[model samples]
Target: MDTSQHSMHNLFEQLGLPSSEHDVEQFIRTHRLFSQDIRLDKATFWTESQAEFLREAFEEDSDWCEVVDELDSRLRS
Candidate 1:
């Protein structure tokens, strides 16, 4: 079982993004989800693989879900 701590920084790394705190904040700030109807995984800015990872993370309710949900919340703001 994977025991590594899951956080926004780690989640960004999992998504193959820059995992720094500032980078995550900048990404969320610039990429607000304009429509409530659009899911995080369906956002156009993500590459296909990133989208798939997000989709699966939520669908499986895996360890990554909380962090992913956090990201979703931030983007929605």
Candidate 2:
């Protein structure tokens, strides 16, 4: 049983990205999803492993889902 809470910072860390608030904001600002049709895991900026993690998180509705979804939304906007 895994019972850990995750935030955007944590999600970035898991994805091997910079985990600071400023870094996350900078990433989101630069990586805006140009098309609504593009899935978060399919975004070109993500490395294969990062994409897989996001895919699995959403597919499993795991503990990481909320923050992953939040990141998805942020990148789109």
Candidate 3:
């Protein structure tokens, strides 16, 4: 299992955001977990494509899964 953190560019790209460190940080700060136990995949902030990417990454347990899980937990918290 590759436990290393992926690049911010990859994460941002997958999320359909600009691939920049500042943007990534700003995005994380701006978006919080929705109330009512909503999943990250259901977050309103994401575009349809971004949401689908997250859902697929999680369901498929792909290489991006760990990062997706991390993002999910962080946003929820």
Predicted candidate 2 versus true structure: per-residue lDDT over 22-72, tens digit per residue: 999999999999799999999888899999999999999999999898988
- Model 1 RMSD in angstroms: 0.8
Kindly list the per-residue Cα lDDT of model 1 for residues 1-77, writing each as its tens digit: 99776999999998999989899999999899979999999999999999999999999999999999999999997
Compare candidates 1 and 2 on lDDT and give the better one.
1
Of the pair 1 and 3, which is ahead by lDDT?
1
lDDT per residue (tens digit) for residues 1-77 in model 3: 77766765788886667878787777778887768478788888888998898899889988888778877776766
lDDT of all predictions: 0.93, 0.91, 0.79
Q: Which stretches of candidate 2 lie over 4 Å from their true place?
A: none
The TM-score that candidate 3 achieves is: 0.79
All predictions: root-mean-square deviation over Cα? Answer: 0.8, 0.8, 2.8
lDDT of 2: 0.91
> Model 3, 20: alpha-carbon shift in Å?
1.6
lDDT of 1: 0.93
Stretch of 10 with least lDDT, candidate 3: 1-10
